[model samples]
Target: MTELEQDEYTSACEHALTNSMNEIKQRYLKLNTIFLVTLNAATSGKKLMALLLRRLQKIDSEFLSGLSGLVMF
Candidate 1:
């Protein structure tokens, strides 16, 4: 490709990446807020806290794996 075309392609790719990162950040924040609320509500129950911890660990591993796959791509 020509220099101008290459630059344009790079710019587009960068913009798309930026948008995707922003979306991921927003989603992570929302999920974090929900988790915090749930944790607070479950503070009185040991069983509930353990369950939440397990679920969160599972979700964190899955999220990390998914991110790794994306990075590989």
Candidate 2:
């Protein structure tokens, strides 16, 4: 091939490789964002459950205390 043809071929290959790399990077970023959102949702769910459990425990304690007073009569 002529030197000019070979240079053009190399430039085209470089462009193709760069495009492929950018596509891969974008997919990775999208996946990372999805994973972070899922993790945050799970963490928030756990915190809410813990708060509910604490509230339930407090209610149970008060109910038991009131029952004991009734039994003393």
Candidate 3:
């Protein structure tokens, strides 16, 4: 391959690698957050569990509403 073609291939590979790394990082963070929340609720008792449930319900409702709005478009 010509030098320009080699350079373009290298650039594309780098971009894909960067995107993969970012996705991995985001997944790790989401898992870590869930783990920490579970641990906290386990140690803190029913109050924390209830609070988390309420927050989760609110988030779920909001997410559903957002999806409905998107579907309307």
Best by lDDT: 1
- Across residues 1-73, which tens digit of lDDT does each residue of candidate 2 receive? 9999999999997896676666556655655565555555666798765655565556556555644554553
lDDT values for all models: 0.72, 0.62, 0.67
Q: Is candidate 2 or candidate 3 better by lDDT?
A: 3
Q: Where in model 1 is the C-alpha error above 4 Å? A: 44-73
- Candidate 1, residue 51: Cα displacement in angstroms equals 12
Model 3 residue 14 CA deviation in Å? 0.2
Model 2: per-residue Cα lDDT at residue 52: 56
- TM-score of candidate 1 to 2 decimals: 0.61
Stretch of 10 with least lDDT, candidate 1:
64-73
Candidate 1 lDDT by residue in tens digits, 1-73: 9999999999998997786676567657755875896688686788777877776776666667656655764
Q: Which scores better on lDDT, 1 or 3?
A: 1
lDDT of 1 at 35: 80
Report the Cα lDDT for residue 29, model 2.
60
TM-score of 3: 0.59
RMSD score of candidate 2 (Å): 26.0
lDDT of 3 by residue, 1-73 (tens): 9999999999997896676666556655655565568668977898887777666666556555645554553
